[model samples]
Target: MESDESVSDSTRPVDSGVTRLAYHNGSWINADDVCLSSRDPAVTQAVTAVERVRAYNGRLFELDRHLDRWQRTTKALDLTGLPSRPSLSRLIDEAIARNGAWLARQKEFGVLWFATPGTADSPTLVIDLYPIDSALIERRTRSGSLLVVTSVQQPPSACWSRNIKVRCRLHYYLADREARQTDSDAIGILVDSDGTVTESSIANLLIVEAGGVVCPPSDQILSGVSLQVVRELASEIGITWREQRISRERLAAAEEVLLTGTSCGIWFANSIDRSPLRAAGPVYQRLRSAFEGRVG
Candidate 1:
């Protein structure tokens, strides 16, 4: 197996010989120069609605789906004074065009939009492009991920809609920190109050049981864009997919465990809480190949 350290340099984008640009409010600025005021509500309270889109061959992938989620989140939060959907769409296009040189240096990249309630009447919007962590992706895909079931529980449905993507993720931060104490590379998986596995810090959890794909119901977890793609891919290939409560015991006995998210796409987990499970099971290989083909 190739070491992540050895693969790191190869996966990184070469110097593009151009400054990257970011969209800030109504202007484009040097990516490094964009910042929010210290007193802004987004900074002080972490009240930001966020959406991320991946670029393949310098083109945004699943853009409409991401934008739909972004709009829904802003509306659910009652955030006022946001740009119209069409205007926001054009801004995202401008952002990508402005950073094309940097994006062309890599096979894929991530573009993120952050919306927040500012200190004044209008809301705040910031858009930036980021490189994917190829080394980490390479490592996880090769050896699978290690997960530790964290003590932190997913916030109840009454607190907010499960589908809203927001920046109030202190719980995830704490969960990852707790997991690191067990294994530096281990990711923390959150469970519901009833001990049903909900999700990981930044990824959605899915398990293959009896040759079928099963994930926690949408009401119990975030409705992930990548997970939705997986669902479509599964159906296209005639693989049965469904949703249900995944207990700790069920997870341990799963035929295979998979993690899905924006940055990482779909990868399997070799162990949870240090117990070994199947790695790169047949279903994972099929879905991963389908996903890669779809992306290309």
Candidate 2:
């Protein structure tokens, strides 16, 4: 029998299995037992940082890179009162061990870990895991969709912790809500303060032109793990890749467009602002195949 910390009591036998793990302060507990106080500053003013790492075949993909980013963000936010890298790593290991059985059954999922300063302005951490929505993953992988929205105005590097994955994502949520209102699949596009194309709300944006494949500089976008993987795959497969500032007009005129992220992997954008293009072109097909091979 599994320990209570590894399984939730409300989890039903027929409900598709799931495992829960949580780490708070210096103790590891069941996910359900990890609670927060209303007095916590992060709860009141949203002072927290987070990173989401995806698991493929029951193993974390690009874990080191995720940890590096997580550390950078917390330190930038002056929250080093949280556990050290070694301590955090041990907790993550425990989390994986606790969830190993469920991970095996799912084949793929995501891990969300975060840290927020305590109510007294001291270091405190909260880590947990939940199953990825399989239906959403299937839909994104099989069929591409459009993002119909405007760009965010902040320069990527201007963020408080530009290199870290932080939890202050109010803007992202706003963009997503706007996308859904128009029946789009995700946030349409993000723009810099000056209105140049930056990225999609949650994914890096790429455009295929007569010259080759182009992505915006990391200076203006979140350096995504999947984006790096795609670039490496593109190079290995003989596709040209470059980083340049792209205008809205250029994106709409491109031969192809795609979004890359931890959750979505790779997805073609059939249109931008209702301008249509091929849904599954040769470049997209080749890149997707290469990426899937690497992950599988």
Candidate 3:
């Protein structure tokens, strides 16, 4: 056991080494100084929309694409006070520049923006940049991941477009908790109401078959920019990629399953619900290299 003074001293900030910055409304501030109202709808009612992008080796990858998605989300969600696409892009670049130390220390960092459905008087907007820990990335890349299916079905997209990313995520939280009951580092996969595999808790899913890479149709899942980019890369490399509704059965039968996201890039799943899916293989390596080569 550690002494209380030792614990308290440990809690105190020493040479923490990283500098963080935040952007809100139209200006930049220290990340720790930013705040959200407890009564805001985005907080109280979970009506926040978000877009997360990456700065690879000091450059933002696909800035136009992610900002384009944010534009659509703002329109569809009726958000306000958000900056224009050009302004948002500049703001992210500014964040990276202002947090120069953090950027210098990291080969990969994340730039995440949030738009809250604020009151008639005001709307909330925020952008933050932080380093993506190399250890977590290494763990997923080295051995792949363990995923478990859960009873908590993904909210049907028919009710609302699955393209919109929101913070109202209690179902996903619970599903992830259930996955932790199985393994500490495990992640949860959500099936749709119709027994089709839709996506994982935070990232999109793609499973490889004899034909090639098959992902659920965008109608059923978010059309992730990373997913689209990888498919284009596959085509450039002469590997076929298609969008088809993947049933739970099809996923279980897959030779390899991968999760895609901006920060994660491409990661493999070693198993899903005790069913062995191939670990990182030649195809996974090829796509991963293609992605890294483009962004890195």
Candidate 4:
């Protein structure tokens, strides 16, 4: 695992061996040197699409699926700044090579890419590679985490970036802050306008009932890559899965609940609003084991 110690301040940019980053405009720079302009329209108005890819064994996992979703989101939003899959693949390869040493020293990391509709009437792309906090995952995996359903809900419009992992995240930030105010490990769960459960601040939620495992339909959620893997694993393991409208009450009452995301992987929820649950339920254990086997 990578050392948690901070890097020295006196090291030169090149000698620091920072992860390499590529933009749509063909600039290769250190990840730390990439900057976001305050005057840019995307920064000012929050017009951007994002995809977070997980890195395992020093390579990107589910890179194709993440790129597909990025393309779909860009097309849907009519945002014009994105590189082709092949181009992005090349950039990713370069990034991996540049960060090879750093990644080899780490247990896991995240590759976050975003494209913003040009502010000065031009195209721009932003991408970076960063290490995942193993401590957070350890806490979540060991005892589970708390989730609070927030009052703020997703908008109904299709162009609102509800289904995309966009950079417009003020609502999520606020909700997450509220959750943290209650408990440091607590995360916010957003609901729809009509009080239907949508997803968490950073992930998709899954519920295991007596009949089968249920996840909210993609119409209202950010259809996560990890969630897709979990679905496939469930099917392979003969666990019934479905897309349905899971109410907050149903989520709170579920026999087992898990959160899925690129970084989160699969994490059981210990409680919802102080309602405790069995951290190691049989169904959860089975699904977790299946997921681990496939990922391993």
Candidate 5:
């Protein structure tokens, strides 16, 4: 029921029958046992760099790539005290082991890693593991999703690039609020300063045309992990994938629109600005099949 939050949050409740374990600093702790100060810069300044990874068949999906971006982002923010890539892998393995039984029951799992500027001495690091709610995933996959273009255009990337995958996300929540006025379950589609379609509140946006699939340039969007996979899948299926400026009009008229992210690989948005729109065009169908074929 969570809207405007990360896709993982929308897919899993706080307690999804998994007594989730979270790794913080140097030890594993109960998810409920994890805490931070009210004044933590991660909160006060919203300066944390984050990465979300899904576990498939007990192993992280694209683990190295997820961690690599996380490292690059934290370094970009000049945040220190984060764990090394090797250390994070070990911690993730331990977390899965601690919740092995619960994890085994899941089709896939969510792991969120983040680092924050801490108590002036060092930074705070945390990695949380949660189970995905199959029911919610099925609903988004089966039932068509919707998007509404809001007046709240994405702030200029000159201020902060979405490429960093950080917590500077208040604007998204507000944009989603505007979208819900059109449809309760609708999400927001943000446009860049130049009026080019960028992304949705929680996922990267793609428009399928007769020629190919198009998404915004990485300089303007988050360049999500699922996006990379989908691009490769499209190539395999003989559908072109490219970066382009998608106007709101182009999106609404598109043969198909997709939102790619950690939570749902190629979720279709069947409507734009509350108007009916097509989804799962032939090219999207082929790309979806190719992408899903790899799931374990």
Candidate 6:
């Protein structure tokens, strides 16, 4: 066991060779110093909400949008002891400055915001930064990603609305693990109980057809900020965007499949469950170019 005294605060920005600083509750501290008790709800019950914001070109992308979603999720989960909006915003800026030297060396990175209901005293709020996996992004961009449809079904809305992003994602973990059993590089895509394609473990799925791009209804999947950006970009380019329930057969027949998330703005999918689909089709190429232009 480590002694609490050894975790004493540093007078200057703290760095452990890997991470620089982190915000815990209302104070900025060493990344490793942010700890939670084993009994905390975030650990014991998995009652935590998280928002991952990507910093592109050293600037946070869609920060307000990410923060809005985080607020909605924390409120839906009734998480308490959160900092006010202004305070949280200022802390984010300070965290970036604290990690400025490290961040400057990387092309892109991620800002993770975590909130959890705590013991009797207070809630847990933390902001941490991490480097993006450029190698993985490069590989996926070249060959496209394999999305394996997993046996694990998405939890019903009765459990919690799909709109609220929470840490209760054992299903996603199990699904991804099951996918890796088939192919080490495969990512898992969960389906509804009725066999409608919902989303991948960490991204929203978009299907391209002759008519337009189709997305899963908001009621069935977490509305991703990246997905919204794609929608806007598509509209600007005169591409139609619609929502519908996508069955496995439709997914197999899709002209192209795209994945959108905070870290990866847009990426193409090569196949699903070993059935090869078009990789980086014309639609995907155009959207990807547009996305890159937007980010740059």
Put down candidate 2 lDDT per residue, 1-296, tens digits, no spaces: 12111111112222244546577787777666776788876778877788877777777888888888887788787886777789778888787788666666654566677788887667678776656656666666667667664745554465464456765666666666666676645555667776778765567889898747999887777888889999999999999999998888888888888889877678778667766535677788889999889889
| Reference-based lDDT, each prediction | 0.81, 0.71, 0.74, 0.72, 0.76, 0.81
RMSD of 4: 4.8
Per-residue lDDT for 1-296 in model 5, tens only? Answer: 12224453344445556666678788777777877778898778888888778765666788887877887798789986667779778887787788776666667677777788887678888777666766766677666588888888887878876677887887788888888888878888887778888887678899888868888888888878888898888787788878888998888788888878777777788778878655456665676677678764
Model 1 C-alpha lDDT per residue in residues 1-296, reported as the tens digit of each score:
01112112123333468777888778888776777778887889878899878776666788888888988899888887888889988988888878767776766677778888877778878887777777777778778988888888988889888789988887777778888898888888888989999997668999998899998998998888999999999999988998899998998888899988876678989998888554689999999999899888
Error of 1 at 244 (Å): 1.1
Q: What are the TM-scores, per candidate, against the unseen true structure?
A: 0.91, 0.86, 0.89, 0.88, 0.92, 0.91
lDDT over C-alpha atoms for residue 246 of model 3 = 82
Which one wins by TM-score: 4 or 5? 5
Q: Model 2 misses residue 290 by how many Å?
A: 1.4
Off by over 4 Å in 2: 1-19, 100-107, 159-161
Residue-by-residue lDDT tens digits, candidate 4, 19-95? 54544457767565666678776778887777777766656788899988888878876877466789888877776
Q: Which is the winner by lDDT between candidate 2 and candidate 5? A: 5
lDDT by residue (31-97, candidate 3, tens digit) is: 7677788888987888888887766666777878887788877888888667778877778778777
Model 6, range 112-162, lDDT digits (tens) per residue? 778888776789888887666677776666678888988899999998989
What is the clash tally of candidate 1?
0
Q: Which stretches of candidate 6 lie over 4 Å from their true place?
A: 1-19
**True-structure RMSD for candidate 2:** 5.0
| True-structure RMSD, every candidate | 4.3, 5.0, 5.5, 4.8, 2.4, 5.5
Model 4's lDDT to the true fold? Answer: 0.72
